[model samples]
Target: MSSTLVVGKVVCITGSSRGIGRACAIEFAKHGATGLVLHYFGDDETTKEIQTLKQEIEGTYSPAKVTTIPGDIADPKTATTIINAGVSAFGRIDVLVSNAGICPFAEFLTMPQATWERTRQVNLDGSFYVTQAAANQMKNQTPQGGSIIGISSISALVGGEYQCHYTPTKAAILSLMQSCAVALGKYNIRANALLPGTIATDINKEDLSDDAKREGMIKRTCLGRLGQPDDLAGPAVFLASDLAKYVTGASLLVDGGLFVNLQ
Candidate 1:
């Protein structure tokens, strides 16, 4: 049997300029993904990073093509743009990693309505729109199948003191995957959630910079350390590969045992 996972497959990963998305993009290429469609929020810094990432991946993995799209995930049209670009470049999209999101920590009572609304629009609503577009493409394709990996968080299962608005969006993403699994299974499309636990990424850099907070999360993990973005790459690969063909509506916690270490 071929040991390579996702060979010749085309993958679309949102927020792939950095963090978990970046790690997954590189891993997928290393494991034989033939094409990559990377999405990022339209900012000069991220735009540059995605371009560099495209060069690095394509150069390192010869013959593997990469397409970068810059847009706000909060806008529904961004999702449409990403899918169309992927299909135009690769003929089909075999996998989608819905990983673009934000977490602006704030106390519940004092949080601004704008904060709550923006988080909802990006995290929850964005995932729905992107997943829907991907699922629709997967359904109508010749093979009639694809895999979706939603980057949810452990906050979906537990609450955060300062993440009242953010947590709900993550939970909703988890629920969205569950429903998509049911709705898309008949078409051979698999939907699953990858709930990461405090993975060290740009998203939580300042929050983790606090010695007390950082150390506390590290100690809480059974692994004795915080998770790196690369930690979730393997699970993501498995889910996107045939290894997880039977896995759908499942929530895989890549937390370094943090969720189970509650004691």
Candidate 2:
């Protein structure tokens, strides 16, 4: 039903070579997106995975279209390259997911200046660059509208120990999304943020490898388990689809009630 409704829509996802971005790409394809632009930084394995994912989806669904573009989100030129790739390959971008992010954990007092700057550049500046490019492209399209999804973290809402540098950037992302949503709504474009809590990905699993740390995370979650990538895929699709047509400048939490439980 939802997939059928989204047929022929073009969705572009950045940092899609792995993790939540990868999962969102596959999920959108399954839901009848006309074409997909999978953006990766420098991971060749992720590029190969995108190819494989395209083939696998095509095998099960008709008109399964997918394309891959590799670039650094921190570079403004690379953002332009990604948008150009999507427009050239798919004609128009119906949805843009700004999902590329990095977190260098350290206490504020001991944090290196370079580390803080890199986090802000990638997490905050990258979002702005990609959103600007995508919005421009969306404005020129026939439908005169598009959806922008910023992948933020629960850290954006609450401060975490040893993550001072990372959380501030995420908070900035939410503010950016809200401002974009208000400004772009007049153009029929919408922007929103998705905040995921403690998902068990390679980035988050470093501590989970320790039983004590892992158990502490599980206990803090109301659901009594860690989050999986798939948990985020559905919500992302909904935001991009017409189902959330009126939902803009809002933040959706997909953390299995971790935020509330922690409170």
Candidate 3:
């Protein structure tokens, strides 16, 4: 009964420079992940914080190898690159946390085509490519098994006021996760989705800026406040670790009962 969750496991987390992605990377390392592939996207000048963050995680956790991988998730090849980098550095990829996503609040009628297309490309298409790459590796590897964690949102289950285009992408991921679970189960690959509620991340700061909009979410939540990045760290690690070996095609909500209390 070793309490460590993912000891000696190799994890790859996309969008790991900040926010929830960063939290997951740290959580896995703390829980005994031996290797980490931190995937990030930026101006290509080489993001310094990503490197600093990697150093801090590896130093704090000690004995874990952390590699920074930069690329655009929108590009199909980016998924291939991230997975390949992980395998090349760690010999194999044990878990993949597809946490890179975007939520641009926009009115349905006013939403530009570019906005819709980019959202589809990054949140849906990119996720599909990454999950496919990870699943294929898991299927062919000697161990013949691995876990895929798709970072979905509560918006997938419930409609949002301004997530007209964004919601669909998240919803698609849930469906995609289920499909992967069914198709890859024979290969021992587990696919699951995590639906986080209104989290206080820099990515959503503008969306939650309005006092009225912020309080509306608070009223629906069972917890008095919004969710923090740390709140999801536990759930993320559990899904990637042996503790959840039997779980697959499940969408676990880390949303303080917000969906349950939906009006």
Best by lDDT: 1
Model 2 residue 240 CA deviation (Å) reads 0.8
lDDT of 1 by residue, 21-59 (tens): 999999999889999999999799998899899999988
Candidate 1 global TM-score? 0.98
* Candidate 1 weakest lDDT stretch, 10 residues: 1-10
User: All candidates' TM-scores?
Assistant: 0.98, 0.95, 0.96
Q: Per-residue alpha-carbon lDDT of model 3 for 74-135, expressed as tens digits?
A: 99999999999999999888999998888887889888999999999999999999998988
lDDT of candidate 1 at residue 242, scale 0 to 100: 92
- Displacement of residue 135 (Cα, Å) in model 2 is 0.5
Model 2: how far residue 262 lies from native, Å: 3.8
Model 2: pairs clashing at backbone N, Cα or C within 3 Å: none
Which one is best on TM-score? 1
List the global CA lDDT of all models.
0.94, 0.87, 0.89
- In Å, residue 230's CA in model 3 sits off its true spot by 1.6
Q: If the candidates were sorted by their TM-score against the true structure, best first, what order would they fall in?
A: 1, 3, 2
Worst 10 residues of 3 by lDDT: 42-51
